[model samples]
Target: MTDSRATQADIAACVFDELKAIVANLPDVTGCAYERAPTDAQDLPCITMQTLDGAPVERRYLDGGRVANYRFALLLRKQDQEDQDRLDARALLERVASSLAEAHVELGASRAAWGMTLDTLPHRAEAGAGFADWRTELTLKYQTNR
Candidate 1:
């Protein structure tokens, strides 16, 4: 018998939940949610996840499956000392990357059929006086049976 196929939403939710669980134990992570960044400064160092785009892998006569790209935004407040905030952001980024790498290996071994790839974008500080909004974009590529 063939394995049951999961819907795109199911796959997305699974990935998001896994990410949430991974980051929940990290230091300075104030919040995690599906879409919509937090408005309160207290919620700084928050992570917002969303499914950006997806498409099927092209192939003839075979179930090539679909690939979905998910985006995770890490937001943090700038400190009084610019260097300190930058350091904190970078530290957090490193931790996130490490966690994702480990998760990818574990998931790959256990799931076998599904696949995941993580692309970490450069961190940037948003404009606006007194607001040190350092943001990092993590692109997660997920594949599942079509």
Candidate 2:
């Protein structure tokens, strides 16, 4: 019941912008931002992002999933992917994931409390071609005040 004729880059950009907007609204924490995606990395088959808390921020990824003709990208941006920044990472990921899911852009996304990761599989429209499914995931790690 949706149009999957969109390009991976377009979808990825959508996801990234959505994520940035959501993460920007986090509570208690500040200085939240997304890293400048590798200029050449865009050519890769995944969409990578990161969230900042205080000092160094953690990285997240959203790569392709299915194969050609039925391209699908499975993004995983869980706050638990890393170890050092796992505490606050959970909350950050939760807000981000929830906002993303609500947007319903790249199809659908999943969220959680401490952390959340989404995999919007490449979908096909009524009729299309020239595209492959891809997969990617990102984890947020945080420091605890405890």
Candidate 3:
């Protein structure tokens, strides 16, 4: 069994790649990019994932195999009219949620020892300045062999 903990960057990379793969099949999100941060240079729709927190939830063995609760945040950014952006963001987020319903597990080297699952109801936020901004978060739980 692996003895190392999965780092935040590792989780982010796995999620980013998985999200990008799913988004690629989305009809309306043809040009969107899966990014780690807002690239400001592009006004196109983009998605980002980040690790918020992690904690051991259960111990399965004496050697550090355990279930861990990892909170991950997904943010969607786009440029559009106030009302339109809100609706667009909602649609995009819904699509994303649907794609992730089965949950992404293992994710190459960032394997979740017991797979992954959505741990909480999604939370959403919206804002408008020159353009509208909308975001949502989903907490995911995965077993880790620390």
Best prediction by TM-score = 3
- Tens digit of per-residue lDDT, candidate 2, span 27-146: 433332334322232232222353322322133334422221212223222222234334344434444455655564442333111333344322221111222212233322221110
Candidate 3 residue runs with Cα over 4 Å from true position? 1-6, 30-36, 39-41, 54-60, 108-128
TM-score of each: 0.65, 0.33, 0.70
Q: Per-residue alpha-carbon lDDT of model 3 for 41-134, expressed as tens digits?
A: 3554666665665454545658765555545666666666667656767778666855765555454543463544544433345544444445
Residue 73 in model 3: lDDT? 63
lDDT of model number 2:
0.34
| CA shift of 10, model 1, Å | 2.1
Q: Which runs in model 2 stand beyond 4 Å of their true positions?
A: 1-6, 27-85, 106-146
User: Candidate 3, which ten residues in sequence have the lowest lDDT sum?
Assistant: 115-124
Error of 3 at 142 (Å): 2.0
By TM-score, rank the candidates, best first: 3, 1, 2
- Candidate 1, which ten residues in sequence have the lowest lDDT sum? 105-114
CA displacement after TM-score superposition, residue 85 of candidate 3 (Å): 3.5
The per-candidate count of clashes, in order, stands at: 0, 34, 0
